[model samples]
Target: MAEEGISPSRQGRPSMTSSMRSSSFLREHQQYRPPSKPENHYGIDTVVEDLQATSIAPPRQISPFNGIPSPENPPVIVESGVSHELSHPNCTPVPGTTSFDRLVATLFYKSTSPRVSNAIPSPIRIPSPPKRAKSPTPHTESEIPPNMSPSSSLDTFPLEPPTTEPEPLDHLYGSYISPMCITSFLHLMSTFPLPPGSTDLNSAHRCLKLDTAHGHHPLVVELTMAPAPSLDYLSLSDLRKHELIYRFEREWNVDVVLRSDTLWRRYPRLVVFDMDSTLITQEVIDLLAATINDPPDLAARVSDITHRAMLGELEFDSAFRERVKLLTGLPGSIFNELRPVLDVTNGVRPLLRALKRLGVKTAVLSGGFLPLTSWLAGELGLDYAHANEVVIDEATGRLTGEVKGRIVGKERKRELLLEIAKKEGVSLDQVVAVGDGANDLLMMEAAGLGVAWNAKPRVQMEAGARLNGDSLLDLLYLFGFGDEEIRTLTR
Candidate 1:
């Protein structure tokens, strides 16, 4: 055994037969130690095979800064995604570390691949978004009150009993209805409640929309009895009853109006409106008050009086006298300076366009000064204008306390409407009147259809129809013009 331990032929080597036996016995007695490396070094090829056999996830590209996946020691991921390896040839293992331990740490602790997060996929189609209306629907049908009682939110007009269906358009009017019937209005044939003699649809006459602010659709008053009348015309009295819509609208802050198809609509030859706060957005008196010395206080006082006067609490004639008296010292040229600043109501231009399209005679009857009214009429292409005349002192060239001629108050306004209607060869029922004051009430009532444009509560209550906003073109809705018709008229 001694000779076998050392080479038998080597003379320099010591014999270690006894030592060899002793070391062997000691190795057999010691506890087991694991290998420093795993039996298989699973690099890219080994990992790819294991991955294919396992879950088969795609290879993840790890950045260099993160541990274990540096430039020299790249991450090992198989295409089939069965397994992975962390150990690299360039990496030196720490004490007690093995391939299995390194693999466990790398697989569990490594950050997600940049390729997965940064990749852009193929484009896919997405549905288009729904379009929205230019103006939101003011209300839904559900919001419209079913009851049309005088006190309810919805006002109703009692329809006369349906009369016998009349003869054809050729038989009634004795001629073909004008081409306007094609482009001027909405449904005038069946829905409109025509008076006794009307056989054909007059598009321009009865074309109107009720206040749409409450809803997208024109205003609809619940009929007292179903099926609106075809025989009777909607008169000033009938128009007044319909004010329940406008009156209750105050509760909702809705701005809209409804014009009835009536005698006035059939023969509408005259369109009359107030000057201040009706045709124009501003009240001439209020604007004039601002022109006075210490205008703030004067404007407040004048506005209060104007408010009271508009409410019918004070006579418009006296109120006009009192209000204008404050303008005694203001230069008459102030009106000219202020004239350019005046803005026509939004509905004014549109309504005027509609009126001109219909060839209706238009007039302005104002309690305000005549220069502004006359200028407005001229600018707006109105045929006539009537207002209180302002007297200028020749020596001082300032406004005098006295107004010339008759003060164009409520009674005068009514007279003017009648006068215009007469000159147009039409009856009082042919006149369409619009205003925003107490003075406008009498004349508004006298006209076939009286419209209150942003008037006082009393005026709104009394007028046939009330528009509760700054837009004047909506008045054409009262004439039954649809959106397309209005657009065409304006164009």
Candidate 2:
């Protein structure tokens, strides 16, 4: 009799159908031979250029995921752009958006690897292996399941930002380090007084560990002859749980991030800023629309579109096109005139300076215009900027009302965040994205931490953090900075 899982056809001697199936599988695989010989098939010139990029680069700090590259697996090379499959699996690499390092494991593996010469890229080329813990069915050449595609089973999963949640104490303490501002923490400590042995915050920059505060259990003072405590706390674990973490957030009026110390500090290696109403006081497009006052009706029409777009009522790209079309007759001089009055939000200058001091990388990713994003980067001391280009009619010296490049919309913002983080050699979780609009949400959610700064209600509710304060400098407080540190820096 056939076993429960075994088919009757395969239970005894191999059936005729089984032999036919094997023959068919062999026939299918025989056709999948290398498309071309390794000597000259693929773009060796691009490969040579990529090799040159790594050869010149200095040895980089190894990633936390895989300290060293795996000998067997290599970075995938999809020279031809990729269309994300319907699944959009972690292994799939989105052209222009997929981080080089993030695509490494998925891109290059023996089973589905592209035939490349021995000269492989480095640093960006090391993917340890697929990091998923779940054991799925093994991949076979004969049958390419969508989920097991080379794009889906990359050796390593795309690293996601680590989240804080209820977990064991040992694991939490392992990643526990600093960044909870000393001033606020100390203030809480004075009232709460830490358990006998845990963390000491007497130092300025980092917290020193006095003791791990382990190897003890407790009985309430009411049951035992032990002395009573002020806050009615028993064990050190309780202190971290109920007081330092939970109550501290409420009393201090700040969200305490409970993530890996290394990842958290590393992050914000790239801090992406949204342009309109975020990095700038005014939407440049809206400002441009207001530039044409002679045709009052056109200006009002454009302004209405701009207002609706900013309010998340209208689509940004279409609104942008319509607004630019209104300015078609306006001379390019209007942009220059508007540039001087273009205020980089009231407190952004100092905030940018403070970030520089912290060694955090900053980027201005605007859906506005490349002209403005680039100019703002210069004034704000930002490291990078990205946005759509505004094509001008050289003959007319006026707006063309058309973008020369791809529109920097919601998906593009998210992609830029990933690209910037990968280029900066940091994980997405180690980055911070701040924005105030609907377009900003995609990028915001992509970062290690998302901060909503006086944003739309939908955004505020979804962002990881929110700042409803007077100055952008208050952002320092989110990193745990106290009043004293903020004043000294500003002064």
Best by lDDT: 1
lDDT of 2 by residue, 317-360 (tens): 77777777777776767766777888767789888887887788
In terms of lDDT, model 1 sits at: 0.62
TM-score of 1: 0.52
Candidates' C-alpha lDDT:
0.62, 0.59
- Candidate 1 per-residue lDDT over residues 1-491, each given as its tens digit: 89787775687767667555654665757698566678765566655555456642476643324445666556775555577776765578677753220000000000111111212233344443356544354333322132222344333443432322222222222122222222211232234464465454322222233334433322321111112334355543553354433332322223333334344554477888888888887888888887766755988999999989888899878888898888778888887998888988876787788789888889888888888888889999999988888899999989887889899987887777777777778777777888888888888889877888778888877777766544677666555445677788888
lDDT of 1 at 442: 86
The estimated TM-scores of all candidates read 0.52, 0.48
